[model samples]
Structure formats: C-alpha cells, structure tokens
Target chain A: MPYVKIELTREGVTREQKQILIKGITDLITETLNKDPHLTHIAIQEIDLDNWGYAGEQVSVLREKGITADKK
Target chain B: MPYVKIELTREGVTREQKQILIKGITDLITETLNKDPHLTHIAIQEIDLDNWGYAGEQVSVLREKGITADKK
Candidate 1:
C-alpha cells in the first residue's frame, strides 16, 4: 500500500475543492501508479500562504511577483 | 506544482532506505506527475508499526497474518 500525504499553501481553496483534490490524487495513484484505492492511504494538510517558503522567499512574495504555486 | 507526501509504518528501515524513499518519490513526482522537482514539494513521515491502523486493525496485526504493506 502506498501512503500519500500532501501539505500545501494556497488561497481560495474551498472544502469542495479539497474533495476534488483528494479524488484526483486517488485516481492518479490508482491509474498512474497502479495501486489499489482501498489500500492507498492519503491525507492533505493545508498550510496558510504565510507559512510556506521556498528559496528563502515566502509564498506571498512569489505571488506578488506573479509567480503562482499551483496545488496538485 | 503538485506536493507529494508519504506516511508509512514499517520495520527494519534504515537511514539509507529513507533517503532512497525520498529520491524515488521525487523522481516519481517529476516523471509520473510531470512536475518540476524544484517546484514539487514532498515530505515523508515515518510511523511506527504500532501507530498505524486500518479497518480496525493495526499494521502489526496484518503483518502477523502474512499480509505485507509494501512501501511505494
């Protein structure tokens, strides 16, 4: 069984969107990875925009510069 | 970018194994998910065999019955 987890920082994600994400991920795992849906465990943790950073730059900083960090 | 994360419960995993897991996951995200390795963020949290449960059964219980949960 493959255990999948996600941590993301994004704005304007609703609960419905989260469900879609979960479904999409599950489908991807099953189709692309050839894993069993029931045996695959997945979890997603939402991080505030202010909480994520990369290359010494915060997500907000990147966004202000027109760089979008798309959630998968 | 798609954020990939993993949580696993297993025994006899060494530090080298953990590194391999990370590299494998990063490659999978880049190749299978078609995401940039730099943009794609991933994390793996190791859970003790006693800490994970499924279908009202612990990992140890399943393993004792000859059911192996393979790490992806």
Candidate 2:
C-alpha cells in the first residue's frame, strides 16, 4: 500500500533502466523502511523540463546549476 | 524509503483535505505494507480531468461508468 511516485524531467532512460530503478528503490524501501515489497506501489512521471521547477528554475536549468547534479 | 504516489483528477480539495488524505493513506501503508510512517514518502499529483485515463476512458468518464465510483 505504500505508493511511491517519482516526477522527473524526461530523459534517455529505457524501460529496462526504469524497471531496475523501481526494483532497486523497492528493495531499499523494504530494507530501510521495513515495508513489504509485494504491497509497495511505485509510479514514475516523465515530465517536461519546463513543467518541473525547483528553486525558481526549471529542472534543466537547475541541473546545469548542479542542484540535481549528484543524483543519478 | 517507501514512497507512495497518487495521481488523480484535479478536485476542489483543500490543503486540510490533502493533508488528511495523505495521513490516512500513510497510516494504511504502515498497517498494510509494514512501513514506517516517518520514512514513508507520499506524493500526490492533481491532473486535469482530461489527462488521466482508465480502462479506455478518462477518469471522469470512468467514474460515471462506476469504475472508480466505489473509491472514496
């Protein structure tokens, strides 16, 4: 029942990568949060750079400014 | 962390309503998914009626069709 949603700028991630990311995150949730992996729900939103803003800047600009530079 | 994401058609829900929904969902997650409330992450996306679809119909139409009519 724990649902996780991720909103990010559209990128070159493939379906395989998406699956891996979700699995990894779900595994981490089970380990760190003591959650049941079977019941966890995850959703990812691929948003346009212009549509997602942070700190008064679009995600693209913020990435260039090193805001999300460390996040892979 | 167990992250929960909810995407729904935009409704006239207030901030208090939003908070209550989040809390209730989080509590359910804790009970059902065995997650810790402190580490659980929940995100809600409010989309226009035209943006969300289910079972070959928009959420609005689906609701009228009694698909999501039972979900409060």
Best by DockQ: 1
Per-residue alpha-carbon lDDT of model 2 for B1-72, expressed as tens digits?
675566667766555555566667777777887876666655556798677876778887775666654447
For each candidate, the DockQ is: 0.23, 0.05
Cα deviation in Å at residue B63, candidate 1? 2.4
lDDT of 1 by residue, B1-72 (tens): 457776656566567655665666566545543445778766666687678887788887888898774424
Considering only N, C-alpha and C atoms within 3 Å, which residue pairs clash in candidate 2? A3-B3, A3-B4, A3-B5, A4-B3, A4-B4
CAPRI tier for the interface of model 2: incorrect
Q: Write the per-residue lDDT of candidate 1 for residues A1-72, one digit (tens) a residue.
A: 568876666566568766765676666545544445777767767777677887788888888898875424
Off by over 4 Å in 2: A60-72, B1-72
Candidate 2's TM-score reads 0.44
Compared with the true structure, model 1 gives a TM-score of 0.55
For each of the candidates, the C-alpha root-mean-square deviation to the true structure, in angstroms, is 5.7, 10.6
Error of 2 at A70 (Å): 6.3
